[model samples]
Target: MDQKTNTVASILFMVTGMATVGVIDNFITYIAVEVSLWQFHFLRSMIAVPAIVGFGLLAGWTLRPLRLWPVLGRNMFLSGAMFVYFGCLGFFPISAVAAGLFTAPVLVMFIDAVWSRRRIGPIRLATACLGFLGTLLVLKPDVGGLGWANLIPVSAGLMYAFGNVATRKWCEGESAVALLWSYMFLMLIFGALGVIYLHVFPGDPSSYLTRGWVWPSASVWMWIAIQAVFSLIGIGFIMKAYLIGEVTYVSIFEYSMLIFASATAWMLFGDRLGALGFVGIGVIIVTGIVIAVRSNAADN
Candidate 1:
């Protein structure tokens, strides 16, 4: 396909993937009331890993990683980020959690600048500042009752940034399918650990983060299956989008997840955001566009 055609296709894939994720993720809150985070991850991965393998085999895609250690390291960070991101969903609005998670691109820029010993130009630095301000506005941390939980989503963003760096530095040339397999496998492992730890030292049954295994109701099982299926579909499209399109151009479309998630949350759950929150989301989206454009230019 021509470059323009490829870009259009990529944008479609990216938007579809983001919308899928945005919708499925809001359902996490529904299940969170009934199951522990660990149990949820464990069960979701249980379903996802086998399904991924089956699909990989049928499609004749190699699931083995070219570099095992790097893939493992990348999965560790990415899985950890999801762990935190999902955990936050049990407590915060999807819009807030998603806005924080989308900070990954900005964090990636800062990490790359420091690790490469490159000076940040004025525009990039200003963009970073705006991004930070946006995060604060979205999170709206209460100083009087400030606690670590308020910053959990940003921590997820940090881990996601590291995972992105690892992907570029070490997992280059690896098959996207292989990376996806390894990531799901690691999530399975992490979920098992969380389940075991909680079993040994259980906490409040009602607490999603602390609660251990519970017999899932039919509804819980259904939602989890839905989560697994939609997540695979979303991830597959996102991987394809990156493979076919310019990274800078494709990455910008990911910001669309913010809009999808926020809108879906409002429609489905009556989750509403104030004017300042919407403004904050806008700022973050604008910052992400600036970063993508500037990064592309710098590469040229």
Candidate 2:
């Protein structure tokens, strides 16, 4: 595809993928009430991994990584990020979690600057500060009485930034399918370990994160299947978007998830944000766009 066509198609794919993810993730709140976060990951991966392999085979894509250790390292970071991200979904609104996860770009800028000994220019430095301020607004630390739980999603973003850096630095020749599979495999392992740990020394049954495996109700199974299928669809489109479009240009559209998720959550669950929260989200989105635009200019 030409650059123009690629850009347009990528935007469509990204927006659609984000919308799909936003809608499906809201279901996690319902799923969390019935099962542990570990069980959700375990069951979802059980359904998703084989389907990924089947699709890869049909597409004739190479599912093997060019370098195993780097792929595994990347997987470790990405899967850990997802673990935190989804775990927050059970306890926090999707918008807050999305805001926190989207902070990855800012974190990436800082990480790259530190690792490369590059000076952060005034514009980038200002952008980073604005992003941090926006995050505080969205999270509203004072509203809920600040606690460690509030920082969980930001931790996810930090880990996700590391995963992104690893992908660029170490997994250069890896296929998307290979990376996806490794990520899912590690998530499966993490899920299994959590389940085992909880079973051996069980915690509060009412707590989603601490609870052990329970025999899933039929409705819980339904939601798990929905999450598995829809998440794969979303990830596939997102992968395609990055493959065909310039990363800097395409990544900006990812901010659409904030809009999509927030809107869907309000519609589905009446999850309302105050005026300040909306402003914060806007600040973060604009700052992210500025960062992407500057990064693109520097690369060119």
Candidate 3:
């Protein structure tokens, strides 16, 4: 593929991957029972392992054994982010939880500047402020209620931003497949621990595994399988996009996942947003994309 075609293809791939994440997340939510992150993850790896290995064979990436220390470090933070973010989903709406986690870009821009020992300019600060304002709209934190649920996704976002910084600095030498392999293994470890913790520590743990493990019908399997396939391809696309596009611009499209998720909710689940929520999400998305475009323009 020509460079331009390659760039567009990469962008599309990232968009598809991110968008698929929302569907998988929301669809799982619709399953009428909260899935244990541990069991879900264990199953995810079981399915993803074969698919990823096959993709590697076709792509001709060498199967390299991961270096233990680095993979452990990277996967620790990555799994932490996933665990916190997904846990937030169990308490909040998928799109709302996603918006809260979207704070990663704001965190990234500042974290990057701080790590590089550069001062953030006023304009960037203002844009971040606007974005936060929009996030609050979506979160609508009711201090008196279980509204603190917003914090879960926000914490997840912070960890994710830190992980992104580490990615640029530490994982530069690693192959994309290698990164995925190591992350998968780490995630498996994380899942096992989570399951053990839930089952052993919680007094009413049987209620969990009993919640919804009923035989999944053909439709659930079909959707889940499609989600998995798209996700794997999407991961490759995102890695390629990060290689070609500036990191910040590439990250901006991450917000599109919110838009896609909300739209899917409306169509598939008849989710409706109040006036303020809709307006707020619109502002949040536009601001994010604008920030990305501005950053790209500045780079060019």
Candidate 4:
């Protein structure tokens, strides 16, 4: 019974974290073009690093793992996934990129099945397919605009799938706060290196792809600060969720992110979806319900 309760709570935490992540994306979208991606990561990590470290220290938690390389490897997969996914935003619509990234859940399911050599029951398989279909409908990827570049986000999904599974399989004993700090620290290092590269070889600031290292305005700093706070709270919950729940089951809940992002976009940008989009939203909700119900059954 306790395990069941924890599973339910973890699912809630994961869903809430994903929703908060949606908000973070919205905040970043406002100033994304103004600041280079590396600068954004570096500046945000400046705030996140201290905050997370302080919290871990205050709580008297272990801030480092027994084995560093595996943890670093896991974080690298996720960080690389995020960077690649964001880079693809320049080539594709945010929705399409997100749809590709959402494929992570399916990959998670597949990887788990293959690694364990266990058969995925029919219900899980059906729901995964339904969820992907719903995501495709919601994203409405542009067939004409699609090209070889579309592979980037799919690769990100694969990386993310590996990272999520690694969190559960390899780093189960580690503190979520510690793992969080490591991730931020890695991003900080990479961000710093990227800024140095921009300094050495500058490019057109106006060009979206080649641009790097712009001096952020006061408002941009404020936005990055807000995003950092969100990352702390949001990522903490997600880390806890993966630590507590089954990876294959937990991953399916991430589809709710699209729903959350759509709602945020509607309120913040006054962006409304058409009828097909609404239908897609309904399908996603159904997908969530199916997964939640099945997860409960499995838990019992």
Candidate 5:
């Protein structure tokens, strides 16, 4: 594919990934608030692993160079981020968590500049600051309005953003197949540990293995299985974006997930944002456009 074709393809991949991930994440949020993070993580990963792996093999994915360490590092960070994200979901409004997570692109830019020594130009830096201001407004930082739980999602955003940066800078040359599968594998391990910590180590193991174990409702299982099936494609698209675009640019696509989530929330759950929320959404949209436009110019 030519460069322009590749960029568009990557962006589409990213958008679709985020759109589908909105489904997965909201469903998980729906469930996790009622159950422990351990419960959902185990059930989701138990299903996600086999499904992602089988599909990868069927699609003729190969693991050339086998870079397991970087995969481990990046995905461990992601796993921790997810723990915090879901924990926050259990405590706060879904839109609130989504707003916090949108700070990731700004965080990614700053982290990349600091770690990679990339020069932060005036435009990029200004956009980052503006985006962060929007986040603070949504969060009502001046009021200290959001509780400690809000920190969970924000922390997840930071870690997830940093992981994307690492993916772009250090692991771009790796096989997309390897990166996706390896990250899934890593999540499986982390999820397994979550299960073990909660279930196996229970002073009364029976309570966990039998009593409190999350029995995924039929609908929840369907959601997870569908996610397991589709997220491989989602992750592949994201990996391609990481390879071909700047991390800041591709990461901004995450805000697109927020857009999808907001619409889904309103349609499915009767959720609506207030004035500040709308402002935050507008900032997210505007900054995302700026990032895309500037990145396209640089690409040319």
Candidate 6:
């Protein structure tokens, strides 16, 4: 009973962490409207670098892990995943982007199954199909309506799943702070590449995607600071949750981020999905909950 309680609590913590990240990302979208994409990444990395180091020291964690190359490679995948995710925000609704990204859990399941050469159970396969259907409803991609850019967030979700698998399979025993710092270092490197690209070949100034680096205004600094703080708290809880709970069960709760993002998008940006979209979101959550419950039962 106590184990069950702890599992439930950990799942809640994971959901809360994802919700916090979703809300923070909405604020990031607002900030991105006025700042360059890479600039935001660069500045957030700057703040997170010191903040993560301080966190490691305060928590008395070993900042150095025994395995270096594997950890770096895993984080590079994560950084690329997030880079595409944030870049999509420049061109798409946060809710839509989030809905697409939440497919990571399904991808995780599929990847694990393939890697193990195990047959996917009937119920799990059905739920995965249903989830994909829900994503289509959210997208509502008609002929020539949704462009190739829509694929970006979907690809990000796949990369994120791969990164998560690498974390669990190869990077165990490493401190969460160490994992986080590696991720931030890659973010800084990616940001520098973005800076160089923009400077050498600029494009439309009106679009955030192609805009060159600019001096951070006071407002940008405030938003970047907010992102750094909330991200630290949220990612810490999330990493702990992943460490403590069954990955399949815990990952289902990550869909809650879409719920939070949808509300935040509506409240802050006057963005709301249509009736079909809401229904699709409902389908995804209901199916995810069912899968999570079944997964937990099997574990027991």
Ranking of all predicted structures according to lDDT, beginning with the best and ending with the worst: 4, 1, 2, 6, 5, 3
Q: What lDDT is reached at residue 227 by model 1?
A: 95
- In model 4, state the lDDT of residue 203: 72
Using lDDT, give the best candidate's number: 4
lDDT tens digits, residues 1-300, model 1? 886677778778878998899778988977998999999999999999999999999999989998889789888998999999999899887756765687776676667667778776777678777876765565444322546665788799889877766766677678778888778888888999999999999898889999978999999999999999899888768766766765534655666676677778778877666687688778878876676556535532
Residue pairs in clash, model 4: none
What digit string (tens of lDDT, one per residue) describes model 5 on residues 1-300? 676666666677788888877765666554643345566666666776676567767888776435667767777776777667766666566667766776788888889889888688888788777776665554444433667756668888888887888887677678777777677766667666666666655543333222245566777667666656666676777777777776776776676776677667777787765687678768877876786677756432
* Reference-based TM-score of each model: 0.84, 0.84, 0.79, 0.93, 0.84, 0.87
Residue 190 error for model 3, in Å? 1.7
The residue pairs in collision within model 2 are none
Give per-residue CA lDDT, model 6, range 1-300, as digits (tens). Answer: 465675787687888898889788887666777778888888888899888888789988888866999888788778888888888888776756765677798888788678667777877778777876775565444413455766778889988888877777678777777787777878988888888899999866777878888877798789899998898778767776665665655766676677677777778787766787688788878877777667645432
The pairs that clash in candidate 1 are: none
Compute the lDDT of residue 178 as modeled in candidate 6: 79
Give the Cα-based TM-score of candidate 6 against the true structure.
Answer: 0.87
The TM-score of candidate 1 is: 0.84
lDDT of all predictions = 0.78, 0.77, 0.64, 0.82, 0.69, 0.76
Top-TM-score structure, candidate number:
4
Clashes of each: 0, 0, 0, 0, 0, 0
TM-score, predicted candidate 3 vs. hidden true structure: 0.79
Give the higher-TM-score candidate: 1 or 3.
1
lDDT for residue 65 in candidate 2, whole number 0-100: 86
Candidate 2 error regions (>4 Å): 1-16, 128-143, 239-254, 281-285, 288-300
Q: Which ranges in model 3 have alpha carbons more than 4 Å from their true place?
A: 1-13, 31-35, 62-68, 135-148, 196-203, 206-227, 296-300
lDDT of 3 by residue, 1-300 (tens): 664554455456557767767566776653324355566665566677677877888999954644556656766777788877766665567766776688887787777788778676666667676776665565444322445655677788888877766666566656777767666666767767766676666534334332323345666555456645665665655555554544544565666566667777778888755676677678777776666546634332
